[model samples]
Target: MSTAGAHTQHPEHTPGASVRRTREKGEPRFPDGPKADPAGSHFERRIRSFQPRRSRVTAGQEEALQRLWPRWGFDVDGRQRLDLAEFFGNDRPVVLEIGFGMGEATARMAAADPGTNILAVDVHTPGQGHLLGLADQHGLDNVRVGNGDAIILLREMLTPDALGGLRVYFPDPWPKKRHHKRRLIQPAFLDLAAARLAPGATVHCATDWEPYAQQMLEVLTAHPGFENTVADGGFTPRPQFRPLTRFEGQGLDKGHVVNDLIFRRVPHADQPADRAGGDHGADRPEDRDAAGT
Candidate 1:
């Protein structure tokens, strides 16, 4: 799955980037929304799980975004459920990957399983561009990228039982005791994930942070709609499919422990009716974890 030998043209050297400019001139951006602020401005109105970071997009990334976004990317602002078949041009099982940093693993998984479409979501512009560029270079039609709030995408854009699997690898630990609530894997998140997952769909999460892993385990185990895949009710071995990412390797070198928790969504017949109708918490300042998704 190594992207070795893939087209390596630098942004300055890449040709035909004008494709984006030409298309943008005539396109109406779908799912447009107001930009979020840093100090919890309007975004703070909702409990946000992530803090918007400032990062510059590379020229290559810029061009790729301009050219590829209209077709494969979307903003985090629509209220209607997206038709998966219409979006991807096929109804293949959709795997939603949240916060796919730089998309090394996302690309590998998408490429590995042609039968599944990988919808990679994140807020980082450069990362989104890099992933899109890789997708184009590799001719991976099964991969689509989203830029915006994953929480909004889950709560609004995707319908219940619409996802086949979800992968959240290496989410920010928000290690500070005071900021622990900002962690993405929470009871509400599990509730939301469970609601969107089809029966038997799996949620796989991995983290190099131990305390965060514990929180994930406890929250996931407690969710009635999700059943842990492990027999002893503990972390499972990293499946062969999940590649060893550079970030994970760096953590390993620093003696950081990594944990992976896999839980399957229970069938509708097995779900407790009360628990099945999950409370889709809205944007509010006080709900720290609510914002984290």
Candidate 2:
């Protein structure tokens, strides 16, 4: 299939000897489809929470990318701001989903809730194609595929309080202690997410890795911008709105204890526009101290 923008190296180039082959000077993998490096050189580089996976795209998936991408897919190029209402052709509240594996759950969620727009972001080419194909197959007009680093989309493309909700399901745990900083649920990420999410919006995250789940809980709890939906300040039961994917089912079969955290964005005094006020009780001293602010 098309490999447009499919470089093996991280987007942020590493110095020294390179192992991956360089494409010829003017070669374009997929001229009419999602770009390989959508946000190339547009923003400062940093440690990323995800790795781009290179896989063989099936004929059907390739066809979907070539045929449907122009209609529903977008490159997170960090070049301009996106008007969510115009992007989805409606004023429906948009929900941002980071790292949808094959997009089965995303498609399901969109099909179930047609009123809410789902902007799913990921770096996997096959999964991107698969999701596109699924969206086309199921007539999921509410679904949109975003290609490239999610951080760029959040930090550059979306405006403050532009999103109604955020979903991070089964993110890479970066299991090694040394690579914990690469984890996506860090305090810095929460800060950015909180800034983009509207007041009272839910930030739902699920993970099977115990340590990562605990870390997510701790960081989210400490953030002054969020408050747990559960009154006990613990993990909440998996809500019906979030479909159980086959990957999650396999994890359950293997006895993995999946933790779902539902934290709501708290309206801040600083954001006058977002001060519609659901619950602003996150200004506690302990929460600020834990957030190291």
Candidate 3:
């Protein structure tokens, strides 16, 4: 999907970025909220650690997302609320699909199983209009779109363990090696994602990039709270209702390998802290290795 977000004009990070703190040398806390920086505050720390790349879509293209910002039909709950919540409708299982371009797969899934409600995030306007139209056509009340940074929406806004599952499909690779840091799948993002996922809920990610697939495996495989549910060479067909995007079909024709990574959320022992491969990988019975969607 063409994103509301644009690619970066400059590299987000420079050499020696790791040692430097993005904030002031010695930061003071605000009495009210985070904005009380006695000195004139700079937003570099807030927008992104590195400079955030931005792209300006045409006015027409930007309209849909603008329309979406106001009350988006329904909240996480089955009830009507002014706000969107991770556990919006009491305790109904909520699934999040990031960057649900045009709602093709999302609409199909919601139609297939009306029991589950899906909260989808995307910045693209045309896609939002397309999805909203489709949902209305199908009379699907289960799908909702929250337009903006999926990262911020998940991190700053949502409550912990609030989501039953998550799906990220075909995110921009940001192909340049140096720009790989700009990719959505990363340690920081995973840590936040882990906190919102309920135990037994699955996080599914798919990509057409072979190297990014391996990179995802390397990073997520070591996560303490998530376990892979596939064999060393396991492959799963696209789940039912996942429409074939033009690019995906083209990639298949060109013989590019598509990789899917599915992970299960491991329950936190007692402490509700983030786990990144601490003793969790130790006890699983070697024979119980399973495959995932």
What are the per-model numbers of colliding residue pairs?
Answer: 10, 1, 7
Q: Write the per-residue lDDT of candidate 1 for residues 87-184, one digit (tens) a residue.
A: 89987778899998888888887787777888898887678878988898899999988877888789878998888788899999999999888899
lDDT of 3 by residue, 1-293 (tens): 12233212224444223222234655632111111121123112342312222333333323333343232422222122223333345445677888876678778877876766788866554566557656756987677775455666676567777677788888887778888878888888889999987766677788899888888878888888888766563434565445677778889999988877778788787745455223322222111233321
Top-down TM-score ranking: 2, 1, 3
lDDT of 2: 0.82
Clashes of 2: 1
The local lDDT score (0 to 100) that residue 121 gets in candidate 2 is 95
* All candidates: TM-score: 0.79, 0.85, 0.66
User: Using alpha carbons, what is the TM-score of model 3?
Assistant: 0.66
Ranking by lDDT: 2, 1, 3
Residue 138, model 1, lDDT = 91
Per-residue lDDT of 1 in model 2: 20
Q: Clashing residue pairs in candidate 1, if any?
A: 45-283, 45-284, 46-283, 46-284, 47-284, 47-291, 48-291, 48-292, 49-291, 49-292
Best TM-score among the predictions, by candidate number: 2
